[model samples]
Target chain A: MGGFGAEIVAKYNYWIYVLLMMIGFYAMIAKRNLVKKLLGMNIFQTAIILMFVSAGVKHGAAIPILDKHEVLEHGVHAASVVNPLPHVLMLTAIVVSVSVTGVALAIMQRIYRRYGTLEEDEILEKIGE
Target chain B: MSGNLHMFVMAAPLVGALTVNLAGRASRKAVLPLVLGFLTLSLVAALGTMAGVLEHGAFTYTVGNWQPPFGIELRIDHLSSLMLVLVSAVALIASFASLQSVAKDLADRQHHFFTLYLILVAGLHGLILTADAFNLYVLLEITSITTYGLIAMGRGRAPLSSFNYIIMGSIGACFYLLGVGYLYILTGTLNMADIAARLPQVNGTVAVATAFAFMLVGLWIKMAFFPLHGWLPRAYNDAPIGAGVLVAPLMTKVTIYLMLRVMFSVFSPQYEFFQHPDVQNLVVWGAALGIICASALALGQRDLRRMLTYIIVAEVGYMVGGVWLANGTGLTGAVLHIVNDALMTLCLFLVAAAIISRNGSLAFDRLQGLYRRMPWTMAGFTLGAFAMIGVPPTCGFFSKWYLILGGIEARQWPYVVALVFSSLVNAVLFFRIIEIAYFRGGKGHGHDDHGPVTEAPAMILAPLLVSAAALVLVGLATGPLVSNLIAQFVPVF
Candidate 1:
């Protein structure tokens, strides 16, 4: 029981991310509303971003930015700095996520305007017309 | 100096997209020539880069002068250079082919169509050239978004289908992103070669396995590999003829190339995951089933474009299965098929576009006596169809021969049988269309009157004929291509 508790605590972030991803995946596949699916997609993307951010965490490291005085006096060691690569990469990913969301929302608007419903089944039925 | 040429390969189409868009706004008439100029520039650059790669072998370009493990890298190797040339050449041909059809099908959205077309081509170029995993993801989304827009522009139900494609494509891209994140968590580098070097240290971990699963699933969805192929047929079927001409040929083929890249380049083939017999068996059998089912589905389609989309699904299975066979012969076949299938699909789709542009429909019934109405177009279609059926001396047969040889070497009898079965199925499929077009008398449509041969405009016919001739030329050139290009690049087992 103690081992289980420790394991859960140690990897809780991954568990949470998995839970969020599953929620998003379920909505994407199971939900009928296109907008709801899009929301799920956003949630899914955000969860991945969270995972990436968490992956960059070094338990006791300082911010990646260096102090001028410390740098001037003595060279800063890389060991004290948190990993910044994931953060940088995720910044690009976040922008991509936003663009995808924008395009998807616009597409949803077009879908709604054309079919008069955002429900997938209803849209399909209308398309069959 | 030569390294910068790779940058030009990607930039030319990008600049073309912008110039075409701006030119469209300024003078509608200027758009076509401007698009042609830019794409021509891009094709020339791609060819120049290909020559450089052939002479110098594989090299990497560090973007912004930042070195790898920190900066985005673009690796131009035999494989990528080969794909770059294929993509730009196809885009050039398809865009040229679009001259008449875009005017007809896309009445008002001609400018927007060309803009998105160029963007799609640029995105594909970027996808093939980028060496950073995250950069590949970004380019994948670019290609996909542009694709959704292009597909939505088609008449009737196209918007809905494009919406469906968006859902599937975004989910696929996100899955890929998550997989890349997993890899980043395991190894701190995003450069593919760097990650490949680092991955073997943690090679068999659950995290690595999960990453592989996620990435493969994501790419399979994108490639529309049989079971995950729900979004492809409708999107391709409902797309505007001009858009279909571009997307149907390039989209899935590029995804397949990405899958191969991830398999061989990003993850070293020596990894136990690739060597596991269970995984190999699963892939080969899954691909075999995909071929049979997709070919059968294609046989049932009445519409020409939809039928070819299913065949694309089947051809995708061929490449996947060949690569999974894990022998030099099989991987060679897969690589060769990548080039062969791209040209074959481009030819077929161009023929479809020509038919629809001139005759106004793609139904099998409407094709009765089409050979009389459009002789050159029919001739091109016949060449493409012969290639599809794996007739001897067409490029398609040589690739299949290599794939079958690989299957035999791997002792994958089912895959071999499936290939043979698919060829027969393809023969039936094409012959059925041929029978209707060539042998049958036009009854309801009165198309048999031997009407004046109104071939597709030179814009379309020229590319069609060039691609058709290319079918035979590439077939003959397969030996040199395999020896000079693919042999050096296929991973040493």
Candidate 2:
């Protein structure tokens, strides 16, 4: 039990991400308002981005950069620099999330224009009528 | 030159999209021709890539001449090569048919529609060709965002459906990204082959299993397999006829292809099949259930286009079950069905497009005396329906044959039963349409009485005929296709 508790503490960031993801997921599925659902989606995506950014961290390591002169004088230690790939990947993911949000907002505007309501149930009622 | 063909396949549509945006601003008439020209260029390049793959076997091209593990790689094995041709061919044929519908439905937004159309095509080509897991995620979003835009352009509840799609699609994509992140943390690589190589060292780790689960679930949502399918029928049904012809045929099929890539390429067959028999069994049963339920739902739809959407859901079940059956024959059926179902769906949707263009509706009540009004279109529809019912000499039969044989070999009786049941349901669904269209005289709509044979315009008719012909041609060539192309790609189980 002590070892498991220590492990949980050691990886608390992952638990936070999981909690954030679940919260976002709940909003996306359960929220009645379209804008709130979009917000939920954005939150969900942010949680993923955070998870990816956290994956790149190495304890007591510098960001992935190298001094050319230092590298020439002595080969650099690989462990001294954080992994850069996950951060790079997260940048693309952030852009995708933003674009998705933009498209969602645009569609929401259209939905509002047509149905005059952002509530899904009300919109369905309007569509039915 | 052959080595650079894959680059051309990805670049032509992208460059064409930019060119169309600029040139189309000058002359709206230039949009269709420009789109077709670029699609033709890409199709030719895809054919060249397929030829090269057939001649030289599978090969990889590194983007910007960077070495693997660092640079993005575009891998063209037998499977992707066939898919490259399929994507390009379908895009070209579908675009040829889009000109009339675009002019009629989206006259003011021609350039915008074709721009999204070209980008969607490029994104699909990139999705098929990319070997990096992260790159695949990026391309998936590009295709998805463009689809949302296209679907939203339609009138009446299309924006709502597109909105729903955006939510579901984002969740699917984010799940995929999360899975990739997990794999990266485990293996320290983003390239698929690299990750697969490194995975064995940590094969038994919980993270690997979690990654696989997340990725598979993400793809299942994207493909709309079973319970994850709520967004598909409405999105496709309410989409503008122009977009429907392009998206309905390709989107789910391509996602299924990606699932195959994830299962076979990123994870070893042994890992996928032998690691968890219980999970595999559960998935196959789920697919069986999905088939029956989707078919039943299809029967309840009053609209013809909506029914077709449910049929797509059922077909997704077929391919998913085939892949999970974990035998050579089953995998072959899944792969072949991917091709056959795409063409079959394309043929059917094109007919729907033509009918909608002429009649302005696909409500079942509106289809009376369609055979007299649009005989050629109905003829094509018959061919497609026959294909869907798995009649011999149509491509759908051969794939179904393989899938059933596979199910029997694997003793997955439920999947086998579901296949037969779906076919019967498809026959009922289609023949009901056919009988209505063929036998019932036009009662309320006055134009149908003594109406001349007003087939779809030549542009639409030509592709419809080509796809309908290709269905039979593909069925006849199934023997060579399986032995030469598909058989090579089936992983040794």
Candidate 3:
């Protein structure tokens, strides 16, 4: 029990992300309100973005930028810099998430206009009618 | 010129999309011509790329002259090249048929619709061509976003259904991104080839296994495979027929192609098939169950459009099962089915579009006496129905034949049974439609009400006939296609 607790504490970042993801996933599936569901999706995407950003961390490394003269003279060591690829990839991800949110919000407005409500059950009932 | 033909294949649609948006604001008359002109250019370039690939083997084009493992690359192998042609050709054919429907559905927003349409074409082409794992995610989101916009432009409950799709699609895309994140952490590279190379060194780790699982689940959700397929039918049914004719056929098939890419390119077959026998067995069984269930659900749908949507779900099950069979024959069938199913689905959707334009509804009751009212349209519909039923001389039969052979070889009897059962179900479903259209008189009206032979316009019939013809031609060319194109790509099992 003690070792398990220690392991959990050591990798708390991953645990937090997983916990956040589960919460968002639950909201997405369980919520009755369409706006809430959209919020859940945003939270879900944010958790993943955080996971990706965290994956690039290094203990004592500096940022990825390097001085050209220093890199040519000393020939830089790979371990001295935090990985930049995940951060770069996450930038694209953030853009994608924003675009998705924009589209979802636009569709939500349309749904509200047509059904006069943002609840899934109510919208479905109206569709049935 | 040939060396960079792949660039043209993607760039043409992209540039066309921008041109449509800008020129459309000036004059609506230019929208259709611009869309068609660009799709034709893309198709020509795609054909040229296929020729180049066949003549000189597969090649990779580095974006901005940046080498792989650092810069993004577009890899054109036999499978991706064939898919490129399929995407371009289907977009072109569907565009030709979309004119009347688009004017009817989105009369005010035609340019905007064409803009989204062209971007989707470009995004699908990019999805097939990219080698970067991260770039694939971006392209996936681009396609999903464009699809959401297109579907929302539909009438009635389309906005609500599009909202559901947005929720489901975002989750799928995020799961895929998470998987790529896991791979990046382990391999320190975002290139698929680099990761595959590094994976063996980190084999047996729980992280690697988890990544594979996440990625496959993500793609299955995106492709609406069985249990995760709740979003597909309603979304496709409510979508504007113009968009339905395009999205229904290509989106799911391309995602299946991505699954194959992930299974083979990012992870070796040895790792996928040999290392995890238990998982592979479970997945194949799941696929079989999915096929049976989707086919059963398809049987219950009342509307023709809704029925076709369920058929798409069943077809997805076929390819997923074929891939999970983990044999050369099964994988070959999956690839071939991807092409044939795209064309088959397009042909059927085109027919639905024509019928919907005339009747404004596709409920089974409205279809009586359609055969006499529109013989040419019915002819195309019959060809599509035959293909769906796996009748000989249509492309569907050849692929299903290979799949059954694969199931037998793998001793997966449940999959074989499921395939035969689904085909039989399809026969009953399509024949029921055929019987109504051919035999029954129009309801609430006399036989005289069956008006003159006012067929769908020539624009719609031309593409329908061409696709119907391609069904036979593709089936006839199956021998060479398998030997030349598909055989070269199926990983040695």
> What lDDT score belongs to each candidate, Candidate 1 first?
0.88, 0.93, 0.92
- Candidate 1 at B478: error in angstroms? 0.9
TM-score of each: 0.97, 0.98, 0.98
Q: What is the lDDT of residue B220 in candidate 1?
A: 94
Which ten contiguous residues of candidate 1 chain B have the minimum total lDDT? B268-277
* Candidate 2 vs 3: which has more DockQ: 2
Alpha-carbon runs more than 4 Å astray in model 1 = B272-275, B443-450
The runs of at least 3 residues in candidate 3 whose Cα sits more than 4 Å from the true structure, single-residue gaps closed, are B442-449
Rate residue B469 of model 1 by lDDT. 92
State the displacement of the C-alpha of residue A94, model 2, in Å, after optimal TM-score superposition.
0.7
Question: How well is each residue in A24-108 modelled by candidate 2, as lDDT tens digits?
Answer: 9999999989989999998999999999888777898997789999999998898898878788888888889888899899989
Candidate 2: Cα lDDT at B6: 86
Best by DockQ: 2
- Top candidate by lDDT: 2
Of candidate 3 chain B, the 10-residue stretch with the lowest lDDT total is B441-450
Write the residue-wise lDDT of candidate 1 on A1-129 in tens digits: 999999989999988998999999888889999888888888898899889888788877899898899898999787899978888888988888888788778777787888899898988787775
Fnat per candidate, as a fraction, reads 0.63, 1.00, 1.00
Q: Model 1: which docking level applies?
A: medium
